[model samples]
Target: MKALISNKVFRIVAFADLLQQSAIWIRNISLLFYVMEQTNGDPVAVSLLNVLEYTPIFLFSFIGGAFADRWNPKRTMITGDLLSAISIGVILLFVLAGSWQAVFAATVVSAIVSQFSQPSSAVMFKRHVPGELLAPAISISQGIMSLFIIVGPVVGTLIYSTLGLVYSLAAMIGLFLAAVLVQLTLPPSPRPPERRAVPILEDVKAGFRYIRGKRNLIVIAITFACIGLGSGLIQPLDIFIVTERLQLHKESVQWFHALSGAGMLVGGAAAAFLGQKLNPRVVIFVGIAFLSCSIIVEALSVWVYLTAAMRFSVGVMTAFMQIVLGAIMMKLVEEAYIGRVNGAITPLLMAGTLAGTAMAGPLMKTFTLVPVYGMSATIILIAAFASLSMKLGGNAANTERSAVHLD
Candidate 1:
């Protein structure tokens, strides 16, 4: 781990990633509050904001992956950062002009650009990080993400409360510019080989065929989709749990999220330590099993502290599942196809999340929170069982490269 962090490229990319992610979270949280204020707390408008935030991942991830596969990773990432800065600048302009609707437009543009940027970042990791060090590297990355998840909202809220909308947008622009500067320091990634001219649709189709040939990849994608569904089901209900079931104030909900973030940090570190010693498949299975159990336990608990504890446990287990799955993919997929494979699976996971979120309200209205929680647990447990069939080996000796044909 020490050696991995000491590597120059890793350090540069990590720093850039931290700035980029912080900017994104700050923008998202600040915008959410801005929209809430402007719309007078209209639930439908707020929900629409959430939908706008995530919809691009569903619609553009595949295309982004295809482009990432074809483009230089470093250039792709730099362009993304630059465009993000410009987009935020546009938002700042809209805010100054008192055109609130244009702020939403800027949000959509940034979200779309992120789909391209994210896969490119994945490509960079695949290209630069040694296979043995990938898990620790990813763990470090996830830790940064988890830390920001806890801090970003607080920072965004603080800025919004203290400085107001224009200043908040200016802060995000500055962060993005910092990211761009750091990204410029990254070493250039090797370009993919030029092939005979082929239609973009054929390129995407070939990526799908590659995954189709790998049973392990299929299993991982499906398991992740289930996890997304389970997460979506439980997320919206947390507010209800705090407000209705546990009889706590809505503001107290931040405690649950904070604890969960702490758990993610601890869990990521543990997974990084265990990466070389344990089979990723076993790690994923155990994480899912525990996460599912935690959800069920949280549902049954009446006390707020117990539920919070369960939320923390869920966070820890989720970090393990995410890191191990990512490590497995990095190990199996070739550098050329990493982008497309990730692009292909993203929508499956996002669709599950959207579907779960869409279903949670109706299910709660009809069957109540306990049943809805139970249903989510059952879905996650099913994913746990499905993970058992994965054939990921315990060590490098049994690992096999994915049979993906890029041509």
Candidate 2:
């Protein structure tokens, strides 16, 4: 942990992530509030915002990843941030012109830019951070994210309420610019030495083959898919849980989210402490299983406190499991392919989330919240079982790599 703290690259990247996440939250919350004001709290307009935020991942992640692999990591990341800033500027102009609908463009452009920048960040970790310290680095990263999960809404609301949408957008622009400057301090990243001079479409095809041929990667893909599906099912229904199940106002859902974020903050610390000492398969299996159980309990519980406890536990386990998985991916994938692997894996999760989210409304309409939540829990448990099937001979470094014909 000490070593991770002292690592210059890690410090720079973590700070940059901090800036970017702050910007994202400001944009997310302020825009949501702005849209609600403009549309008089229309649910469809709000839902459209969610779709804009997520659909970019499904549409652009793979291509952005391939580009990340093709470009220098530092350069790719900087370009992404710069483009995001520019797009936000454009959106600000349109807003000033009274084109309120252009606010959706802010969500779309940033989300698309993230699909590129995010994978490059992983490649930076793989290249710059030492293998032994990777877990702690990721733990710190997730911890920062969890912290935002707790505080972001409040911050965004404060800014929007006080300064209105214009200044809120300005704040986002400033944050992105700050992130770009921090990232510029990073040591120049050299492109991977094993680069193939193939067309991107061919490289993407190679990425698919790479995942297909590796047993562990295959299992990881399945696990991601399941997590996405299960998460998607319940994400849209949390409000319903508060209103119908717990007999509380819909606004009370914030407490559950806050509790979950608090749990993640603590869980990140614990996962960092455990590090490689915890067996990957067992830890993940337990994490997902616990998450499944928590959902089931949340579904069945009429008591508000019990439901909040489950929500907190879900956050803790999510942070723990995700940090471990991230470290494993960094160690397991070759630096050359990290971007592509990430790009490939992220879309699957996003696709599943979208699928589940789409299904959640209809499913709830049919059977109500409890049974729908139960089905989501059942799907997550299946993911836990899937994790057990991963065959890790030892460490991620020792995992077998798949031979691909990039030619």
Which candidate number would show the highest TM-score if scored against the true structure? Answer: 2
Q: All models: lDDT?
A: 0.84, 0.88
**lDDT comparing candidate 2 with the true structure:** 0.88
Model 2 residue-pair collision total: 0
Across 134-202, the per-residue lDDT of candidate 1 in tens digits comes to 999888889898988788788878888898888888888898889888989888777677777777778
lDDT of 2 by residue, 1-407 (tens): 78888888999999999999899999989999899999999999998998898888888898888888778889888889899899999999999999999999999999899988999888888888999888988998999999999999999999999999999999988999999898889997765676548888888887887777677788889999998999999998888889888899878888889999999998899989996798888889999999888888888889988888888888888999999988877777777678888999868887888899989999999998888999999998999999998877555335465454343
Position 10, candidate 1: lDDT: 82
RMSD of 2: 1.5
lDDT of 1 at 147: 88
Worst 10 residues of 2 by lDDT: 396-405
Task: Give the candidate number with the greatest lDDT.
Answer: 2
Badly placed stretches (over 4 Å) of model 1 are 394-406
